[model samples]
Target: MKLIDHTPQSLADYTTAQVANLVPDGRHQALREAIGRHQDEALARTIACIDKVAAWRPGEFNYLHSSQYCQYLYYLANTIWVREKDAASATRLFLLNKALNGIDLFYEIAMPAHFFIGHSVGIVLAKATYGDYLVLYQNSTVGRHIDKIPTVGEGVIIYPNSAVIGASVVGDGCVVSQGARIVDRQVPPRSMAFTAPGGELALRPAPEDLLREYFRL
Candidate 1:
């Protein structure tokens, strides 16, 4: 993939610099080395992830793009956490991503391979069961209730101000509408979820075309 204004090594250096400035935990060397060691793999994984987003340019990564940068930072942090088992280094990257992107994604959460972050602001993601072709918009949440996490299926779009929590099972090709909540319910595949009168979950059939708005799948 083509990187805009940065090679892999330069991006690693730049990311480490950001962590040093923002986190300032005096572990710059460790984080720098960790990022340097894992940057190439992390960026290759990021390219695989971003290539699925229909809204983005194919085969090009622009660090100046806020949402793309957010995704890359998450992959870098996740790679360090999973491969190096270095929580300190990973945590710094997570914090730096939150600071710069206004998103609250932690390092421990295991996201799917190909998901899209439409906007990065105020999106708090829990360690829920995410699937490929997932779309998370600004102010959207995927959280747990009383330790019961959500299961979001493939080809799903969680629009702005929407949430699926508390053991909710969202099926494939579902669209959680704006300002809707699906709490402990099972939404059928290829359905759209919204709030019925008096705060009940309502469903209607949805087209796969809706999900294609955000993903190429």
Candidate 2:
């Protein structure tokens, strides 16, 4: 994959500099080293992710791209946590992502490698069961209620301002439309969840394979 305006070493340096600038008091020498050690694996993971998104060119990564950078930061944090077991650096990366991207995706959250995001702003995800090809947009949320996390299946899209909460089951190929909320309810596969005229939940078959819009598959 081609990284625009960044070599491997330069991207690692840039990441360390960004994190250090955001948080000025950390012991960053080791953090820098850890990042260098794990950067290749993280970038590989990120390439696997963004390459599947239809909006981006398959073999190129633009560091200046907001959505791509957001995914890169996440992959780096996750790599540090899983490979180096360095929680401090991982937490810093997570906080830096939140500060820079306006999203709250913790380092511990397990996201699918091929999932796509329409926008990176105001998105929040809890420790939920997320499947492959998950699509999310701005202001979308998947949160837990009293430790009952949502189970979201593959090829699902959660639109802006929509939420799946409290043990909700969003089945395969479901679309939680804009402004819809599924709280403790089950949305069957290949269906669309939207707000009815009476402001209640409504389910109907999805008009098409919406994932085609975001993913190459």
**Model number with the top TM-score:** 2
| Cα lDDT of model 1 by residue, 104-142, tens digit | 998888888898888889899999988888888899988
**Decoy 1 TM-score against native:** 0.96
- True-vs-predicted CA distance for residue 171, candidate 2, Å: 0.5
User: Model 2, 80-199: lDDT tens per residue?
Assistant: 998878999998899989998889998888889888777989999998999999998999999999978899999999999999999899999999999999999999999999999999
Candidates' lDDT values, in order?
0.88, 0.91
lDDT of 1 at 214: 74
Residue 109, model 2: lDDT of 88
Predicted structure 1: lDDT: 0.88
lDDT of 1 at 215: 71
- How many clashes show up per model? 0, 0
Can you give the TM-score per candidate against the true fold? 0.96, 0.98
Report RMSD for candidate 1: 1.2
